[model samples]
Target chain A: MKKLVQDDIRTGVFICDCGSNIAGYLEMKELVEFAKTLPNVVFVQENLYTCSEGGINEIKLAIPRENLNRVVVASCTPRTHEPLFMSACEEGGLNPYLFEMANIRDQCSWVHMREREAGTQRAKVQIAMAVAKAAKLRELNRIQLSLSHRALVIGGGVAGMSAALALANMGYEVDLVEKRDRLGGILNELNMILPSNEPPDKLVNNLAARLHDNPKVTIHTGAVVTKTEGYVGNYVATIRQNENENKIKCGAVIVAIGAQPLKPEGLYNYDGKKVITHIELESKLKQGDVQAKNISIIQCVGSRSKERTYCSRICCMTAVKNAILFKEASPDTKITIFYRDMQMYGVENEQLFRKSKRLGVRYVTYDPDRPPRFDGESVSVHHLRMGRDIIVPTDLLVLSTPLVAQDDASEISTMLKVPINENGFFLEGHVKLKPLDFATDGVYLCGNARFPSTIREAISQGLGVASRAAGVLSKEALFTSGIVADINPETCCGCLGCVAVCPYGAINFIENRGICQVNKVLCKGCGGCAATCPSGSARLDGFSNQQIYAQIEQAMAV
Target chain B: MSDSQFEPKIVGFLCNWCAYAGADLAGVSRLQYPPNMRTIRTLCSATVGPHQILKAFQKGADGVFVGG
Candidate 1:
C-alpha cells in the first residue's frame, strides 16, 4: 500500500438513510449539509442503504471521480457494515485502512426517534468527528501468518473425544491428552447415560475405539498439557507424562476438562456413607448395594448460595433421574425429594420429572432459610404447601450438589492466556454468539469447563468446538488487523508498565536496548499498552492519540 | 447563557467489543434515550488516554463517559 501525505488528505462523507431506519427519525438533508461543512470533506452523498449494491457502487465510483483519499460513511454501526465500505474503497484504488465510519442509525436515529432536531444535531456531530479522524487516518497493512495443520485436544472427556474424532476425520492430525489413566473423564464413574439409558462406559468405549483406530489421532493417557505458547494458527504445547515431557505443535486447542461435583462435606452432615452425594449413590446403585428402605434426597446442597450464586443447571434433572431409577428398582422404598425449586428445563427433563411423580416419588418444596433437619433417623422439614412441619422416615440421605469448575481450571486458563469467570469456569468470547470460543483466536472450550453441561450438551459442544477450530485450521494463512500498536524506540523509557498490563503478552522488553517492543502478530489491538505507556511512545496505528484528540475537539466544537 | 438555554456537551468513548456492541443492540431494539452524548468508538476502553479525556474537558465538554 502506498502512503499519502497530509496535504493530499481528501475525505468524502457518505450519509446513509438505511431504508427508513435512519431517515424515518432524522433529517437527512440537514446531516448532509452539516457533513459538507466539516474540514477536508471534499465530497458528500446520501445513500438509502450504504450496504446495498447500488450504494456501494456509488462509493466506488465517487472515490476515483472525486479523488477521495479518505472515505467516511455515516451509517449503521461499523461493526457490521465497515468491512463493506472498506472493501468498496479498496476497489476504488484507496487503501481500506483510510476508510472511517460513524454510526448514525444505531447511535443517533434509533436512540432518539422522537427528538428529530437533537438526533440530527448528534448525527452532524458524529459525522464531523469521523471526518476529523479521517483527516489523520493512515494506511495500514495486514500481516499474514503461517498456519499449522495439526490440532490439540486437552482432557479426554466425552467432549474432548468428540472434538478429537471430528478433527481427525477432517484429515488433520490430532493429539488427545488425558490426565487420568483412562479416557472417559467423568463418564467412567457415571452409571447410566440419560436419553439413551445405555451404560456410561459404552459411549466412552465406542469413542475411544474410534479415536484409537483413526490414523490421524494419537491418544496419551496419564498426560497433562503443562505449557502452551503461541496464538491461533501456530501453537506449541508441552505434554507432561509420568517422567517425560513431549512437545507438540498444533493450530488449535480444545479444552474439555469437565468439572467435578461438590462433595458437600459439612452441609447436611454428609458422611459419604449414609449421607452421601447423588454421584456416590450412582456407584452404590451400580454395585446393587443400595439397601435402604427409605431414601430422602436434598437438592441445592452446596450451590445457589451467597458463596456459589449460580444455579447449576443440570443437578435437578440428575436428582429426578436418580429418584425415578431408585423407585423402579424398589417400589416399596419411600423416597422424598426436598428442593427449593425444581429446575427441570426442556421437554425431555420435564417429561422425566412428570414420570418421576407418576412413579410415586414425592417432591416437597423447602425454604432455604429453614432447611430440612436430620436427627440420624428421620428428616424434618417445613412444607410450604401444607404450611406445617412434616417428618419423613429416611435411612439413606442423598444430597444433590452442583458441579463446580475443575481444580486446575485457573492454571489452564493462565497457560492458555485466556480468561476465567469468578467461579473458575473458562469464559467464552460472547455468552450468546460465540459460546464455544475463547477471546483468543485459536483456543476453544466446551463441556463442564465452560459450565455444568449434560452429557448430550457436552458431546454437541465437543463437535461444535471442533468445527470452530477447523474454521481457523482450514485457512491456509491468517491475516491480523492493521490496527496493532507500535512503540517509538527513541521515546521508550523501559518503565515496563505496558508489559505488566498486557493481557495477550504481545509486548516484550528488550533488555539489551532497555526498551519494550510489540510483537505485531500477537497484538489484538486492545491498546492497553499504548494507554499505559507514560512516555507516549506506544501508539495504536489506526487509533492514534492525535486522531482521538482531533475527534474530541471536533465533537466539542459542534 | 441561561441555565435552560445551556445544553451540556458529553463525550463518550465506547469500547468496540462490549459497550459499543451494547449501544448498537439498544439501537437495534429501538430503545430510546436522550441525544445528550456524542460517542467515539475505540478498540478498547484502555485506548482512551487521560490526555484525550482532559482535552475533551479543556474543549468545554460538560462530561465524559468511558464504557467498555
Candidate 2:
C-alpha cells in the first residue's frame, strides 16, 4: 500500500440530491462549486442519490480518477449511510476510516425546507466542514482478537440448563456452574409446573438427566465463580467448588441466576405455619396436606409499594395457578384471592385465571393504601366493587410476594463488568432490539435474573440467550472498532481523570509508568475520556482534536 | 448586534445516539427550523469540550448548542 502525506491529501466530495429531498430545497449547483474551494478538495460531484448503486459507482470511479485519499459524502445522516460510503471507499482501495459525512438531507435541506437561500448557504458550510475534517482524517486499522469456542454458564436453574443444552447441541463445549449442591433452582421448591400440570421435580429431573447425559456439557454443582476477567471472545473465570478452584476459559458467559421470592416475614402477619407464602403453599399442595376449607390468598404483599415500586410480573399468574389447583383437588374448599389487580397476562395465564373463576374461586380487588387486615384468626378486606368492607374467615393465608434479585447479583455484575437496573435485575443491551444481551459483549442475561419471567418465557429466553452466545462463539475472531481512545505516553499525567470518566472501564492507570492506557477492546468510543483529560493526553482516534478543530474553523468561515 | 438586524451564527454539537437521530427524524418528518446553526456530530455530548464552544464564539458564532 502506498502512503500519502498531508500535502498529497486529495478529498472527493459527493453531494447527494436524495431524489430532490436535498436538491429541491438547497441550491446543489452552488454547493458543489463551494466544495471545490475548500482546502484539499480536489474533486466535487452531485448525484441524484449518493446512497444508490449508480451514485456509489460514481464515487468508486472518482477515487482512482481523482487520486482521492479521503472521501466526503454530503447526503443523509452518517448514522445510516456512513457505512455504505465507507465500504465504497474500501472497495476503491482507499482506507475506509478516511471518510467523513455531511448530513444535508436530514439536518440541512429537510429541516430548512422553506428557507431556500439560507438552506443552500447552510449546505455549503456543512460541505466545507466535512471537507475540512476529511483532510485531517487518518487511516485507522481494526484490532482483531482470537476467540475461545467454549462457553461458561453461571447458575444451574431451568434457564441455565436450557441454555447449556442448546449450546451443547450446537457443538460447543459448555461448563455449567451452580452455587447450590443440586440443580433445578427454584423448580425444586415448586409443587407443580403449570400448563403441563406435572410436578416441578419431573421437569427438573428430565432437564437434569438430559444435561448429565450430554457429552459436551460439564456440570459443576456446589460451585461459585470467584473471579471473572477479560472481555468478549475470551474470558478467564475462576470457579470455586468446596476446597478446589478451577479456572475455566470460555468465549461467552450466560447469567441465569434466577431470583428468589420475597419472604414477606413481618408483613401480612407471615408466621410460617398459618400465614405462609406461595412457595410454602407449593410444598403443602405437593404433600396434599390442605386441612383448611376456607383459604384466602393476598397478592402483592412486598412489591409495588413505596419501597419496591416494580410490579412482579409473574406473581399474579402463580396465585391464579395455585388457586386453580387447590379448587380442583378440593371442590368444596372456598378460596378467595384479594388482589390489587389480577395481572393474568398471556393466553395460558388468562385461561387459567378464567378456569379458577369457573371452579368457584372468588376474586376481590383491594386498594394498596387500605391493605387487608389479618388478625390472628380471620382476614378483613375493603372491597372496591361492593362499596363496603367484606370479612372473609380464612384458615390458610397465602401471601403472593414478588421475586427479588439474587443476593449475589451485584457481586456478579461487578465481576462480569455488567450492569443491573435499579430493581437489581440485570440490564440488557437494549430493551427491545437486544433483549438477551448485556451492553458488555460476550455476557448474556435470561430468566428471573433479567426480570420476573414465566417458565415459558424463561425457557425461550434461555434458548434465545444461547443463540446470542453462539453469535460470538461461532465467530473466528472479534474485531474492535478503530475509533477507540488512545492516551499519549509522552504527555504523561498520572491523574486518574480519564479512568474516573470512562464508563466502559477501558482506561487503566499503569502504576509504575504514571499514565493511563486504554484497553482498546473494552472501549466503546464514547470519547468521554478524551474530553475529560485535563492534560490533553487522551484522544479518540476518529474524532481527534485536530479534525474537530478543522471542522470548527471551516464552520465559522460561512 | 441589534436584535432586529441580527442573524445568529450558531454551532451545534449533537451526540450521535439521541440528539442527532432526533434531528434526522425532524427532517424525515419535514419539520422546518431555521438554518442558522451548523452541526458537528460527536460520539457523545462529552466529546464536545469547552474549547470547541469557545472557539466557535471566537470565530464569530453568536450561540453554541450542545445536545446529547
Candidate 3:
C-alpha cells in the first residue's frame, strides 16, 4: 500500500543531437549513456533530430518497448518541441501532459557555445528541476465547462459596437456595456472617417441600431464594470449603471475598449489654439478654422521609440488624411507632413499617399532623434533627406499622436484573468493567426485595447472576436484542455501559498483535506502555482521534476 | 497591517482599467518593488474604488499611484 509509485512511473529519456544546433556544443552519446543510471529510466536513446518524425517514431517505439509512462526530451524550449514529444507519448498510450521538455538548445548551447561545460552543467540543473516536477505528474483528465450562451462586451467604441453586432447577428445573446451616456464611442464625434470618405456617425448609428433590434443584444449605457470575478466558462461581472453596480454572469467576455487620444499638454506649446492635437485639428477642420496659408502636421508624437516604442500605425494615415482634407479645403495651403517613416501598407493607403502628394501636400523627412522645433508661427526642421536645417512658415501645427487603450485596461485584464503586452495592450496569442485571442482560453480582446487601430481595423477586430466567442459558447459542454493540474494532497501543508499566487483564481484552499484544490476548468497550466508551492505539495501531471532531471542528467553526462 | 508607520500602507488603485495587470506582470516577472503598497482593484480608471486611494493617503500612505 505504501509503494513508491516508482514501479508505476516508468520514464524514457531521449537526448537530441538537434541537427548541428545542439550537437555542436553538447555530447549526446555520453548523455544517452547516463540515462540508464537514473532510477526510473527504463530506456535511453539518442536522436539526430528528436523533433524529426523519425525521432518521434523512435519515441513511440520505445514507449511500449520500455513500458514508459513518462518522457523527457532534452533538446529545445517547449515552446517549439514540447508538442512533438507529447504527441509521441500520446501515440504510445500515455497521457500527453505527463511529459516535460528541457531547453538545451536556445537557452543553453546557443547562449553558451564557448562554455560548453558550463552550458551542460546548467542544462543538468534545469533538467533536474523539470524531472522533480514531472515525477509526481498524475494522469490528467479532460475539463468540460458548462457554459452559458451569452457574451458580454465592455466598451461602446467602434470595436465594441462591431463586436456586439457580430455576435448578435450570429444569434448569440450579447450584453454591450458602455461607460458614456451615449453609444458610438469616439466615432460619434467624428465628422468623416479617413480613406473611406464616409460619415462615421452614420456607421456608428447603423451598428448601434442593428444591435438594438437584434433581440439578442442587450445594450447597457452609462455602465462600467466595477468588479470582475471568475474565469472562462463562467464569469461574474458587476457593472455599474445608474449609479449602481449590476451583477451579471456570462460564459465569455470581450474587451473592445478603444484607446483615447494622447493629449498635447506640455509638449511644445499647446495653447489648444495654435499648437493643437490631430483630434483637435479634426474638430478644427469641421468647425471651419480661420484661414492659415501654411499647415505643418507632425507625425509620431508620443509613439514609436523611447517614449511609446510601439508604432501607433494609424497616425501616418491620419496625417495624410488631414493633409488631403486641408488641400481640398484650401488648395493654396502649404500642407507639410513631418514623418520618420511612413507606413502606408495597403494598396488603397498607398494610393491615398500619392493622391495627397499630387494634390500639393508636401512630405518632409525628420529624424526621431532630432524633432522639428516649433517656434510660435514658424517651424525649424532638420531635413535629413535634404541635409540641411530648413525653416518652413506654418499657420497651424498639428501633432498626430497615438490613440491609447482605455485607462481601465489593467482592471479589465485582472477581472478577465488575461495577459496584456508590455505596452499595456491585451496580448493576443499570435500576432497574426489568433489576433483577437488572449492566452487565457475563453477570453478575447480586440481593437485599440490591443494596439492603436483605425475605425476600419476596429470594426474588423470586433467581428473577428465575436466569431471566436461564438465558437466556444455555441457548444453546450465546451471542451477545455485535457491537461489539468494535478496535486498530491498528502504532501500539502495548507499554507494556501499557491492559492494566493494564482492569477486565474483556479487554486482554492479546501477545508477537508487542508490543501489547495485546483479548479481544472479555470487552470491555464501556466505553472505559477507549482512554481510557488514551497512544500512541494502540488505537482503538475506529467511534469514531475524527476523525469526532467533524468533527461537533463543524461544529456549533460553524454 | 497598517498599524505601524514603518508598514508602508501604499494603497494603490490599480484601475481594472490599466495598472492592475501592470502590477501583475511586475509580480510575474519577479520585479522587485517596495512592499509598502497594498493594491485595491477597481474597474475603470474613472471609477475610484470607494475613495480608497484617498483613504490610504489619509491612513498615512506616503505615496499613491493609480494604474489605468
Candidate 4:
C-alpha cells in the first residue's frame, strides 16, 4: 500500500442542474450550493448539460487555476457518464480513475417522483456515500501479466468447431474439448441449416476435419473441464477427456456450452412418441403429410422465468420456419402458432412474418398470465382481443420451448470464478462494450451458454471470443487495472474474508504467516475486498478507501 | 418553455434483449423518444448491474422506467 500523502488535495464538485432534469423537482441550486460547503471542495459549479464540452472545459479550467487533484460529478447513471467525467478530470490534469461519479438521476429522482423532499433527501445521502467512496480513490497503474498464446474451447459443436478453426487459422493453438463422444452436439440433432437448406452435419464435419488435420489444434472428445482455475492470460484448467484426466495451461477459455431443448414434464404427458418437440416435428414434416388434419405449435411453453424467463431468442424464428413447413406440405391441415409475441425482428423476418400470414399459417397471441392449455387431443387458448377462448383440435402438439443454459453452469462458474445471471446464463463484462468478456479475465462465454442464441449468433459469439482471445494472446505483455486486491500484512488478522468475496479466487491466506496475498493475475480490483474487510486491511490498488475518503473530505471542505 | 412542460420523461432500463436493442433500432431508424426518453443498457432485464435505476431517480427525472 502507498503511504497516505497529505498534499492539500483540492477537489472540484460539479452539481449539475441538467436543465431542471435535476432542478425541477429537487432544488439543484440548493444542491450546488450545498456542494460548495463540503470539505476540500475548492470549486463548486452547476451546468445545464455537464456532458457538454463546455462543462467539461469548466472542469479542465478549474484544475489549473485551483490545483484540484480530485473531482466529483452529481449527475445521471455513472454507467452512461462516468467515463465522460473521468476524461474531463484527466483533461483537467487529475487522474481519471481518481474521479468518483455520484449517480443522482436514476437512483433518486426518477423512482421517487411521488415524494420530492424524500427523493432529494435520499439523493443527498447517496451523493454523500459516493463522495465517501470516491474520497479514497487512488492513482492506479495497469497490472501486466505474461500470457500463453493458446485457446481452450469447450463443447465440440458447430460453435466450438468454428471457433477452433477460426483461432487455428489465425495461427493460435486450439484445444477443442467436447463432452459428447461425437463432435456435434445439437448439430447431430439437425438435418440442415435454415434458409440455405444445407446439411449442418456436413458443415460441422468439414470444420472438425480441419481441426483434426491441423497440428496447432488438439481435439478432445468426450471431455469436460472438471476444475477450472486462474484469471486472464494464464489459467490452469483440468479436464477429464475420454476417461483420462489432465490439466492444460492456456491463456484463454471459451465457454460455448450450447443449449439443451426444454422438454416439459407432464405437459401433454409428452412421451416423446405422442407429444414431441420441434426436432421430432421436423422429422415428421420431412416424411410428408400426416393423416391428421390439425397440428398446433405452442410457443413459450417452458420459457420467459419461474416457468422459464428468457425470450429463447430463436424460438419465434424456429416456430415461423416450422409453421412455413406445415403450410407447404398439407394445405388442408391447420397449423396455428399460439404465441405471446412473434419476435420476427429483422427485415427478412418481417418478410417471413408476412409470408406466413399469406400462407394461411395462423399466428395467435395468447396472454402470458392465462396461457394456452392442452387437453391431450386439443389445445384451449383464451384470446384477449376477441374476448373468447377458442379450442383447436390437433393430431400433433409441438411445444417450441427455448434452448436453456446447461445444468452445469453454476459448477462451471464456480470453477472459473465468473457470475451467472439470474436466468443462470453467464454474465458479460458490459452488455454493450465487452459483450463476450466475463468480469473475470481470460474466461470468455459464447453460444447458448451466454444466452439462448440461434446457431448463427452462437457461431458469431464463438468467433468473436476467438478474435478477442487472439488479441490478448498476440500481446507480448498483458496489462490490466492494477486496481486488484492487495493485502496489508501488518493488519492481517489471518481470517479469510477476502477469499470468499473474491469472485475470481484471487485472494488467499498463505500458510504459517496466516496473511492474505493477492494473486495479481486473478484480482479484478472491484474493491469487494474492502467492503468485506473487518480490520480495514484489504484494499484495491487505485480505488483505495483512504484516497476516496480524502477526496470526499476535500470536496466537502470546499 | 415547452421543455419544462409536463411531458412524461421516460427513463428506460432496457435489457439487451428485445427491449434495449429495440430502443437502438428505434434510434437507428430515428425513432424519436419525445426527446425526453433516455436509456441505460443492462446485461438483461434480470440484473440491472449497479444501482443505476436509483441514480436515475435521484437525478430528478420525472419517472424512471424499465423495458425488456
Candidate 5:
C-alpha cells in the first residue's frame, strides 16, 4: 500500500460521455473546463467512454505524466463502476483506495435531461466536490485472514443431512448437529411425499445412511449450538449436549433447523383427536391409527391471515397429497378439500391435482371473510363459486396449517447477527440472486427455516447452500474492507457512546488506556460508531471528517 | 413575481446500498425533479455525522436530506 502524502496530492479528474448517455444531456466540454479550476486538480480530460479499454489506458498513462496521486472519475454510479476504476488506478502504480467517484450521469445529466443548463451547472458542482474530496483521499490497506476448511451444519433433517453429504463429498470435514435423539426431522412424522407418492422414510433414510457412513461427516445428536463467535472464514461454535460442552471451529455454517408445523387449536375446533393438524394426521396415518369415512381437509389454516400475511408455499400441495392418499386407501370414503386458492405449482403438482380430481376428490372454494365453521360433528363452508352454503358431515377434520418459524429463530438470528423477516423466517441476502446465502458472509440458510418448502425444494436448497458454503471454504484467505472506524486515544474520553451505538459490537473501551477501541476486522465500515461518538473521537479511515467537510463546503460554493 | 427564482439549495447524503440505487433508478426511468440538490455518496447512512449536516446548513444549504 502507498501512503499519499500532503505534498503529493495531485488529483487528475476524468469525465466520461458514456457514448452520449451523459453527453446528450449535458455539455462535457464546459464541465472539463470547470473541473480544472478546482484545487489540486492538475489534469482534466474527457472521454467518449471512460469504462472502455482506451479510456482506461488514457488514465494509466496520465498518472505518471501528470504526477497524479489521486484520481477522480465523474461518471456512472460507484456501486457498479467503482471497482473497475479502482483496479485501473492500481494498474497505474497508484493506491486503489486513492480513487474517488462522482456520479454525474445518474445524479445530474440523466436526471435533468430537459434542463441542460441546470444539468451542466450541477455536473460542475459535483465535479468540484469530487476534487475537494480527492485532495483529502488516503491510501488504505486490505486485511487478509486465513480460513478453516471445516464446516458446521446445523440440524440433521433432510436439508441438513443433504448439505452435510454434499460438503463431505467435496472432501471437506462437516459436523452435523441435531437437537433430537434421531436424525430425521419433520420427515419422520410424514407418511408419503407429494409429486412422487413415495414414502418420505425412504428419502430420509437414504440421506441418513450416507451421512452416517461418510468418513468426513460427524453426527452430533441431542446437541444445541450454545454460542458462536468470530466472522467469515473463521467461526467458533460451542455445542452442548446433555452435560457436556464441545467447541468446533469451522469456516462456514448452514442453518437448516427447519420449522415447526402450526397447530390451529381453538380456531378450527381442534381437540387434537377428532379435529387435528396435518402433522398429527400424518403421524396417525403412518401408524395406521386413523379410521374415518368422511374427511374434510381445510387449507390456509393459520396462514395468509391478517397476522401472518405470507403464503405458506407448500400447504396446498400437502393437503392435495393427503386427500389423494385417503381416496386411494378407501375408494368409498368421501374426501372434501375446502380452500381459498389451490397453489398447485409445477407440472408434477398440477398433474397430481388433476389425478386427485379424477379419483373423485371434491374441491370447494371458500372465502376468507366467511371461513368454515366446525359445529361439533360437521363443517359448514360458504362456497364462493356457488354463492351458497355447503354442509358436510365430518368424521375426521384435518387442518392444513402453515409452518411457523422455530422458537429459537430470533435467538439464532441474534447470535449469527443475521436478520429475520416479519413472518419470522430467516432473511436471505437476495430473494433471486442469493437464495440460500445470508446477508452475513459465512452463514447460509435453507429449507423451512427460510420459508415453508416441499421435500424437493428443501433438498434443492440444501444442495445450493452446500455449493455456496464451499465457495467460501475453498478460498485460501478472506480479504475485508480497510475503511474501518478508528478511535483517537487523545480525543476519546471513554464516554462509551460509540460502544452503545455500534450495531456490530465492534467498539470496546480499553480500561487500561481509558479510551474506546474498534476491532477493524469486525467493523463493517458503516460509520455508526463514528457518527454516534459525542467527542468526535471515532473516525472512519478513508471517509474522514476532513474529506466529508471538504465535499460539503464545495457543494455550497458559488 | 420576483426577478430571481428561489431555487432550494439542498445537500443530500445518499448511502451506497439503497438510496444510491434508487437515485440511479430514477435517472434510468427518466423521472424529473427540481435540479437544486447536490449529492454526497457514503458507504452507509450511519457514516454521516451530525457535523456533516450542520456543516451543509452552515455553508448556506436551504435543506438537507440523509438517505439510506
Candidate 6:
C-alpha cells in the first residue's frame, strides 16, 4: 500500500464538458484556467466526456506521466459516477479513496443554465474546493477481514427456506432458524396460492423435505437469535432453543423473520367470529370447514388509511384469490369483493382477477370515505356507480388486512444494529441499488421483513439475498473502507463522547490509559465520532479537520 | 439584499449521505438556487466541527450552512 505524504501532494483535476451539457451553460476554458491556479494542482485537463473511454484513458495515462497521487474529477453526481472515476484512478496506480468529485454538470451548469456568468463563477469555486480537499487527501488501503463460509438464515418460512437452500446448494453451510416449532411459517396456515390455486402445503412440504435432506443445512425449530456481536465477515450469534443457548459463527446473516397479519379488532365490527381476518378464513377454507352460502371480503381493512399510509401490496390479490376459491368450492356460494382499487400488479394477478370475474364473483368498487358498514350478519355499502346504499346479507365477512411488522422487530433491529423504516419494516441499504442488503455490510434482508410481499416475491428475494450473502462468504476476505475514525492518544481527553456517538460501536474507552481507542475493523468511516470528540483527538483518516479546514478556507477565499 | 454587485461568498458543509445527495438531486431535477454558496463534502454532518464553521466565517465567508 502506498502512503500519501501530504506535503509532497501532486493533485490532478479533470474537468468534463459532458457533451455541452455543462459547456452550454458555462465557459469551460475559464474553469480550467482557474483550476490550475489552485495550490498543489500540478495537472489540469478538460474532456468532452470524462466518463467516456478516451477520457478514462487520458486519466489512466496521466497518473504516472505527471506523478499525480491525488485525482479530482469535476463531472456529474458522485452517486452515479463516483465508482467509475474511482476505478479509473485505481487503474492509474492511485488509491481509489484518494479521489474526489465535484458536480459541475448537475449541481452547477444544469441547474443554473440561464446564469452563465454566475454558474461559471460557482463552478470555479466548486473546482477550487475540490482541489483544496485533494491537496490534503491521504491514500488508504482497504481493511480486509476473513469470512467464516457459513450463513445464518433467521426464518424458516418460504423466504427463509429458499435462502437456506440457495446457500446450501452453493456449497456453503447454512443454519435455518424458525421461531415456531414447524418450518413452514405462515404458509402452513394459507389454503391455496393464487393463479395456479396450488396447495400451500405441497410447496412447504417440498421445501421442508429438501432442507431436511441437505447435509449442509441445519434446521433449528423454535429457535430465536438472542444475541449478536462483531461486524461483517465475522458475526457471532447466540441462538436459544429448548431452554439451551447455542453459539454460531457465520460470515453473513439473512433476516427473513416475515410479518404477522394485522388484526382489525374494532374497525368494521370485527369479532374474529362473524367478521374474521383473512388468515382465519384461509385456515377454514383449507380445512373444507367454511359453510357460508354468502361470503363478503373487504379490502384495505387496516391499510391505505391515515394511520397506515402504504398499500399492503398483496392483500388485494389475496382477496381476489380467496373470492375465487369460494366460488370454486360451491357454485351456489355467492362471493362479493369490495375494494377501492384492484392492485393486481403482474400478469398472473391480473389473470387471477379476470378468472375470479369469469367465475361469477361480484366485484364492487367503493369509495374509501364511504366505507362499508358491517352489522354482524350483513354489510351496507354505498354503491359509487349506482349512487345508492345497498345492503348485502352475508354469513361470513372476511377483512383483508395488511401484514404488520412483528412486535419484536425493534428488539431484533437493536441486537443487529440495523434500522427499521417508519413503517417498521427493515430498511434496505438503497431502494434500488442495494435492495437485498442492509446499510450494515454483513446483514441482508428479504421477504415481508422488508415489506409486504407474496410467497413468490419472497422466494425471489430469498434467492437474491442468498446470492448477496454468498458473495461475501465465497470471498477469501471482505475489505471495508479504510477512511475510518482514528484516535490520537497524544491529544486525548477520555470523555467517551466518541464512544456514545458512534453508531457502529467502533470506539472504546481505554480504561487504563484514560484515552479512547478506535476499532478500525468495525468503523464504517462515517466520522460521527470525529466531530463529537471534544478534545479533537478523534479524526477520520482521509477527512481530517485540517483537510476540511483547507477546503473551507479556499472555498470562501475571494 | 438589493446590492447586485455584492455577491456573498457563502460556505456550505454538506454530508456525503444526505445533503450531498440532495444537492445532486436538485441538479438532476434542474432545480435552480442561489450560486453564491461553495460546498465542501464531509462524511457526515457530525464530522463538521464548530471550528470549521468559525474558520469559514473568519476567512470572510458572508454566511455558512452546515447540512447533513
Using DockQ, give the best candidate's number.
1
Off by over 4 Å in 4: A1-141, A213-215, A283-296, A304-306, A326-341, A353-395, A421-423, A429-434, A483-518, A521-558, B1-68
Q: Which candidate's lDDT is highest?
A: 1
Instruction: Estimate, for each residue in A256-317, the C-alpha lDDT of model 3 and write its tens digit.
Output: 88778889678768778888888887776677765778889888877886767888898898
Clash totals for all candidate models: 0, 0, 32, 54, 0, 0
| lDDT, candidate 6, at A281 | 91
Which DockQ-derived CAPRI band holds candidate 6?
medium
DockQ of 3: 0.02
Error of 4 at A307 (Å): 2.1
Choose 2 or 6, whichever is better by TM-score.
Answer: 6
- Per-residue lDDT of A474 in model 1: 95
TM-score of each candidate structure, all chains considered together = 0.89, 0.90, 0.69, 0.65, 0.92, 0.92
Model 4, residue A154: distance off in Å is 2.1
**Prediction 6 global C-alpha lDDT:** 0.88
lDDT of 4 by residue, B1-68 (tens): 58666655445555645575565455335332233444433434533323444545554556766676
Indicate the residue-level lDDT of A131 in model 5. Answer: 81
Model 6 — interface RMS deviation?
Answer: 1.1
Which tens-of-lDDT digit does each residue in A1-558 have in candidate 1? Answer: 112235678888988899999999999999988777777778999999888999999999999999999999999999998888889999999999999999999888999999999999999889888988998889899999899989999999999999999999989999999999999998888788666778898999999999999999999999999999887889999999998998999999999998999989788778999899988898888898889989999999889998999999888998998888888888888899999999998898889999999999999999999999998899999998889999999999999899999899999998998899999999999999999999788899999899999988999999999999999999999999889999999999999999998877899999999999999998889999888899999999789889998889888887
Give one digit per residue, the lDDT tens place, for model 3 in B3-63: 6645333345454324755654453343544333433333334333233344445545567
lDDT of each: 0.91, 0.90, 0.73, 0.72, 0.89, 0.88
| TM-scores, chain A, per candidate | 0.90, 0.91, 0.75, 0.70, 0.93, 0.91
- The interface RMSD values of the models, given in order, are 0.7, 0.8, 17.1, 11.1, 0.8, 1.1
**Candidate 3: segments with Cα more than 4 A from true spot:** A1-79, A97-138, A169-171, A266-269, A273-275, A287-296, A300-311, A334-343, A363-397, A410-435, A467-558, B1-68
lDDT of 6 by residue, A1-558 (tens): 112335688899999999988989999999999887777788999999999999999999999999999899998888789889989999999998889888888789978988999999989878877877777777788877787999999989999999999999999999999999999888998988877668989999999999999999999998999998987878999999999999999999999999999999788888877788899998887778888888999999989999999998999988988888778777888898988998998888888889899999998889999999988878899999899999989999999999999888889899998999888899999999999999888899999999999888999999999999998999987887778988999999898889989987788888999999998888878888888888888889778988888777767663
Decide which is better by DockQ, 4 or 6: 6
CAPRI class of candidate 2: medium
**iRMSD computed for candidate 5:** 0.8
